[model samples]
Target: MGAADSVTACLSKGVGALVGTIIAGSKSFIAKAKILRKTLGSGMRQVGVLCAPALFTLEENKAKILAEGLNKIKGLKVDTASVQTNIVYSDILKSSNITETHLCNILEAHRVLTMPKGPFKLRLVIHHQISESDVKYTLSCIQKAVNGFIG
Candidate 1:
């Protein structure tokens, strides 16, 4: 970050940090921020408990695992190379005879969660807690759902 640049990032949802954010910037910005923090009485204690898992999440390759599995499923298109993070976007093909919402519902019935981005686009997020086995199960469920829709 530049001398004038300041950034605030939330660690609650993706990294599994239930609460907390990181505020960082140049020395001048930090000096001003500290005074503001003191004025606002914003103090924290024992934050390492949440920070540890967030750190762990950064080191994980769970998103790649899920993205590769998604690429193998028929009637879906996933550019695995574009998966640089924990989010995977899959486009449902016309051959699948399935709408995004319908497919999302089917996956949800199988205890898998996904979000529909559009009529034929689905969004899946890989979190720190999702395991390889979970990815396999999710893939199996999606393959079955797509095949059922086409057949």
Candidate 2:
């Protein structure tokens, strides 16, 4: 396998292991919760509040939105090779003429949101509050701002 494939495989395995651990631990906790519920009369009430289904649904929806938005950006590249779970790794070339801080400022000014992971790296995420239009607008704004800065 090539370098990208190797990295992808490694990340996939690592993420799988981590997720397995979390699942096993959660099951263990559920057993304890069951015992506590019977002893404290808080079984159904507390478990209902957790809402694991809703949380998982939200996670899936957010991932879909993010994938759509990331594809919309022209110059920014997405590296799907190393992505295993919701976490995505991408790279921005130094020649892009776009500083990470400039992008951050543009997003902030537009009231959109993102996080910078490196000097040339940016991370945009989707959650309940963000929409597709917001992603498009943020990308347009970043393009305009970077062009203006370069000019």
Best candidate according to lDDT: 1
Per-candidate TM equals: 0.75, 0.54
Tens-digit lDDT string for candidate 2 (1-151): 4433111123223322212112223556767755865797653545434455334533445444454445455556666544435444345556666777777776687776668898788776544344557656755765665556422
Local accuracy of candidate 1 as per-residue lDDT tens digits, 39-84: 8977657768867877776677677788888778888999989876
Report every candidate's CA lDDT: 0.81, 0.53
Task: State, as a TM-score between 0 and 1, how close model 1 is to the true structure.
Answer: 0.75
Best by TM-score: 1
Question: What residue pairs are clashing in model 2?
Answer: none
Model 2 lDDT-worst window of ten: 15-24
Residue-level lDDT for 100 in candidate 1? 90
Q: What number of clashing residue pairs does each candidate have, in the order they appear?
A: 0, 0
